[model samples]
Target chain A: MDETILKTEEQDFIEEDICVAENLVYHKPKTLTDTDLHYCPGCGHGVVHRLLMEVVEEMNIQDKVIGVAPVGCAVFAYNYMDIDMQEAAHGRATAVATGIIRVLPDKLVFTYQGDGDLAAIGTAETIHTCNRGENILIVFINNAVYGMTSGQMAPTTLPGMVTTTSPFGRDVKTMGYPLKITDLVAQLPGTYYVTRQAVNNAGNVRKAKKAIQKAFQFLQQRKGTCFIEIVSNCPSNWKMTPVESNKFVEEVMIPNYPLGDLKVPKEEQK
Target chain B: MGELRLMKGNEALAEAAIRSGCDAYFGYPITPQSEVLEYLSREAFNRTGMIVLQAESEVASINMIYGAAGAGKRAMTSSSSPGISLMQEGISYIAAAELPCLIVNVSRGGPGLGTIQPSQGDYFQATKGGGHGDYKLIVLAPSSVQEMADFVRLGFDLADKYRNPVMILADGAIGQMMEKVELFEQLPRGGTYSKPWATTGKTKDRERNIITSLHIDPRQMEKINLRLQKKYKEIQEKEVRYETFKIEDADYILTAFGLGARICKKVVEIGREKGYKLGLIRPITLFPFPFKVYSEIAEKVKGILDVEMNAGQMVEDVKLSVNGKTRVEFYGRMGGIIPTPEEILEYFENKFLKGE
Candidate 1:
């Protein structure tokens, strides 16, 4: 019994040494509230939210930034992020953000929307706000299916991907092609920077954080719409474990989305 | 008078909005009210540095107003009936969020794009919660060009006071017709009003402010509805405004609003000349309805004639106000038709005075 106790004490000492402050590599972003996240376990939304809050904290614009939340899974974003937020009607975030930035021209504004909200109901607002060159940032999360409404077909859903609405697996002939909305938005003259990213792993999460930071900086520069499309995963609705969902995103989603900067300002053209 | 000018009611309202220190104007072109957008587009930017945007559509314009107003900026949008119909959803959200904003509807005839001419067909839609839910817009009916200019400030003030959307309900005739107007002095852009509810930003001094209408919990949403109801009741008690035109010792009353009231004023004078004892009650604020004034006049008058440019929408409110104490009759000219003063007088002679 004493030998067992000594062995346990030695193991605890090793863990304590490894977990010391000097060895700590990461912590929660300052902008994220202390409240536990309401997102599903292993869902990409929490990671995206954390990365966004981290970027906002790193940029030190917490006091000057206003965010518009969409009517989907991220609807409770205001409760999680310690920033002023306007909850927009389905697909009206960009329009609402346009209104805010127009009047309070000194403030930084961004809209966080999902594929269903941005690509379907909010098509007009999304297209026109960008066309008007409103200096705002838009962070789009495309998870192929509607996560909030329990896995319905989305505008960005793969042509043959099955959803509740498409019970028999989406037939391309009937379901039509998945919209490449980011590409379409890049064609508009009002957009200054447009990129597609993901957050499936540590490296991708870092890239997405950098993209969000740049989009916000572009808004400060009075550049037109700065758009970042994040192709994420919906493990719970995808009916797969988080690991399998991550694998699906890597193998299937990336081929369809193809991450990279689709457009950049002339000065940053490369 | 600050400065008397012969201005169309639409242009006068636009000028008044500028002087009221509107921070932004997002509008789309619609007939009979197009002059408002044009005038603001030409004048507001240079005069007050107001943000004037000709939105792609009225849907976009109202949403823009929603955004700007959410940021605590004084914002407005002007549209005719068809455009206003498109704006109903955004207006409902604005009302639900309790954001202060102004909407001026220079109404045209419409069940659907009926005409670009003068009509008060939208009385029901205006006063009785045109948008969904238990929401009420402070509906102000302006009778003349002077009132059009005057109500612009009043609408903004009442909207700010209630933290609700306010509407200036004018018909196409009142919007297009030119008359003398005395413009009010400009209020400062950041006036005395403080908007702590606005989603401006999260300053260090206060917690973050959220502008939202969504309450997933039914009990919580009911509380919001009740709060809105309490505000509407308070407005009804405090902001009931109507002009009594020679109602003392009158045998009958002519109830009308906006351009209909303008015509009814002439009818009252001519009916008096004909020895019919007709008086007019002009509703300045249509939603508050001035129901108490009706009760006060109910004993003096034998009957009431509700005149409108619709097929008798406000007459229902008139009947409810009179409560069958006095006989209530309605005469209307729909599909962009405006009843002449002579026609109204003849109707008063035949319908109420002579009891034919």
Candidate 2:
């Protein structure tokens, strides 16, 4: 017991010896709380959460922003995000965000939603809110499967992809083709900026961060609905290791749902 | 009289909402209640800068109310029977989150779009837990255009006082019928109460506040349920309200609510002219129901007649109030049919004083 105590003390001392500054190029933003995330290993939700808060922190608008969390895997996003956050009912985050932004027009607002919450049940709300030109940022995380409920086929699930619901792979002839909701919404005049991004690699992560920053800037300008669809991966649901799942996202997901800006403001046209 | 004017019940309620300093009104177009949305749209926005939005559906409207109320704004929505049915899900969430808001239901007959005519059919859905969990709404049954106007302020106050949703349950007839109403003086927005628990973007001086009803832990969920039950119990003890007509030394009592009670008022006079000692009991607050009055009246009255537009929904509550000490009978007109005062009196005499 004495030796164990000595070893623990020595380990503590060694840990203290290794300072945080040496090669410490990155750290969590203060806009994120101290609560440990309940996300599974290698899930894109953690990175997205970090990057979103980092942008909020960088902009120095943490106190002036409110976020609505959807009723999917990110339902407890309010637990981690250190802002005035509201947890919305299933498929109602966009509508909930609409309410907030309408009441507190000057306060920056955003909603983080998963595909099932946005594209399936909340499609009408999402469409109407965007159509009404509600000035808010909508960060949609489309992983192509319902991660929280265990790999159910989502509205964005790729054709021929096997999910728990689609036991024999998705047949578009019967299950209907995957919806390109962002593509659909980009055509609306209310959408100021609409982009499909990915967080599969270091480079793509940077791009996603930039997109979020631009969206927040647009929100500050009151430039109507800004949507960012992050084509993320759900490793646990996809039945692959984190690396394999990301490789699948890069090779499979991107080819079908192409990344990059689908729409931009009129002044920034071309 | 502060701004006395003759107005329809729907118009009076809308005018009252503006005067009560409501922060936002979100609703959809449904028959018998569309006037609420139209009235607010025509008169509210340009004057008060209040957010008035016509949502896509009752589902959208209620969720919008959830968001606005969660942010500590005085929010509300209005709809008829089918529309209120669609709002039940969001209403449950609002109640669980303990956000103060008002919901007005100018109810129509429904068992799936039964009719666009008047109804008190939603008594059970309004008083009982309408959604998945154990929760309650402070239900106000407005019988007159004046009550329709007056209850808007009272509903908001009760909602703010308890941090729970308050519902104004009216029927199609009351919503359409015009009567004299005195609107309250305008109150400034956000001046009535301080919202310490609102998710209004936490500032430097305060800790962040989260508005959510998702409690993952069973233990924590039970604790929340207990807290809600305690609040409901307190409301029941304090908020019981009833309007009586000639109850002193009466042998028979007539109990009804909303327009049904208005009809019963005349029934009381009709019965008295015929030498029957009759009185009327009108429940003002439906959820914190005037159960005590019925219990006390049961000690002396021979019987009680529960008149309603629905097929005897409130009769169940009337029975519970009397607790079988005295006979509680029901007389109902179904499918949007409004029984006349003479018809109700005849039914009462046939049911109670027959062959006298």
DockQ of 1: 0.83
Model 1 stretches astray by more than 4 angstroms: A1-16, B353-356
Q: After superposition, how far is residue B6 of candidate 2 from its true place, in Å?
A: 1.1
By summed lDDT, which 10 consecutive residues of candidate 2 chain A come out lowest?
A: A16-25
Cα deviation of A66 in candidate 1 (Å)? 0.4
Q: What is the C-alpha DockQ of each candidate?
A: 0.83, 0.83
TM-score (chain A only) of candidate 1:
0.95
Candidate by candidate, in order, the iRMS in Å equals 0.9, 0.7
Backbone clash numbers for all candidates listed: 0, 0
The sequence of per-residue lDDT tens digits that candidate 1 reaches over residues B214-303 is 999999999999999999999999999999888986898999998999899999898888887888898888988888888778877888
Clash pairs, candidate 2, are: none
Which number leads on lDDT?
2
Question: What tens-digit string does per-residue lDDT give for candidate 2 at B52-78?
Answer: 999988899999999999889999999
Which residue pairs clash in candidate 1?
none
